[model samples]
Target: MRDLQADLAICEAATPGPIQMKPCACGRCNQFLLSITHADGRFDPENAKFIVEAREGWPEAIQRALKAEAEVVTLTNQLYNCGKAVFERDQARQERDNAEDKVDRLEDELRMLQDALNQRYQP
Candidate 1:
């Protein structure tokens, strides 16, 4: 895919007024900000039906924007994983606590039965 810089250059070269009014390839009106060549032999900028100023800033600006977007996506993924881990840990802890409580109750019942037997047989 063409880097943002190449795409921006195409936008800058196109006629500003017509390009602004023209519909993008996606059928959306002027939604395409830039275009660049792709590896699949697609995204041809030569036959672009629109016109815009070909500025030198196109590449740099697009690169920065892409980097920022990647960072945001990474951060979102990290937060989701962290939340899942915390939930799992809490569930495990609760299960352990419940098992301990059951064992304590069972032990108390056994001790009470032994004491009653001893008192009855003492005579």
Candidate 2:
């Protein structure tokens, strides 16, 4: 599986803006085709022609892609930091529990020894 962070980093570093658009015409029908040229120089669906559903979506798609990429990056960082904090907290809790268990064991031994001494003195 491709890492999204790496892909986004590469995209942001290499291509810093929206994909270019070129107004083209259909070869067979001589009809106008709205073409979207990506930063990678690849045309959008070369086989299928776009009839310009909405010019708004062209730029909107770019903005959405950029926004989505940023959101993913932010969420990924949050998840990593949260996971590390949870692991640290769990480790600290385990250590405290282990220490308490050791102290309880020592206290029980001391109580046993004191009780034996008291019985001997009474008798």
Candidate 3:
């Protein structure tokens, strides 16, 4: 199988502007064609580095692949964010539990000190 991207890259490097497609007009059978041309749609056969015959449905397949790739990227980002949020929530819960434990210890110490003072001053 031919590497479409590599072929496109070579054509792009050899020419200026974006790649364009049009129906072949070389007196041959009706077929779609690919070529690099300037924005004004000017094509020079002498400077043409390469011309590819685009098979039917090739363009649509490329578009679908591009859309699928974009969706994959978006889903990957969302997964990462969800993992981060879970980690942060667990960390916050741990910190709150530790704080509560410290408060309980302080309250117990305060009660003991009050009892000691009362006994010392009792008749």
Cα-based lDDT for every prediction: 0.63, 0.62, 0.71
Error of 2 at 61 (Å): 0.9
TM-score, each model?
0.51, 0.51, 0.54
lDDT-best of 1 and 2:
1
Question: How well is each residue in 16-65 modelled by candidate 2, as lDDT tens digits?
Answer: 33444454433555433223444444544421223232234346557777
- Judging by TM-score, tell me the better candidate of 1 and 3: 3
Residue 29 in model 3: lDDT: 67
Instruction: Indicate the worst ten consecutive residues by lDDT in candidate 3.
Output: 49-58
> What does candidate 3's lDDT look like per residue over 1-123, in tens digits?
456676566555555647567776667768656565554555565335444323423564587779899999999999999999999999999999999999999999999999999999999
Candidate whose lDDT is highest: 3
- Candidate 2 root-mean-square deviation in Å: 11.1
Give one digit per residue, the lDDT tens place, for model 1 in 6-114.
6656655654433222235667455544334243434345434222323434455677779989999999999999999999999999999999999999999999999
Candidate ranking under lDDT, highest first, comes to 3, 1, 2
The regions of model 3 sitting more than 4 angstroms off are: 1-54
Candidate 2 segments exceeding 4 Å error = 1-56, 119-123
Off by over 4 Å in 1: 1-54
Query: Which pairs clash (backbone N, Cα, C closer than 3 Å) in model 3?
Result: none
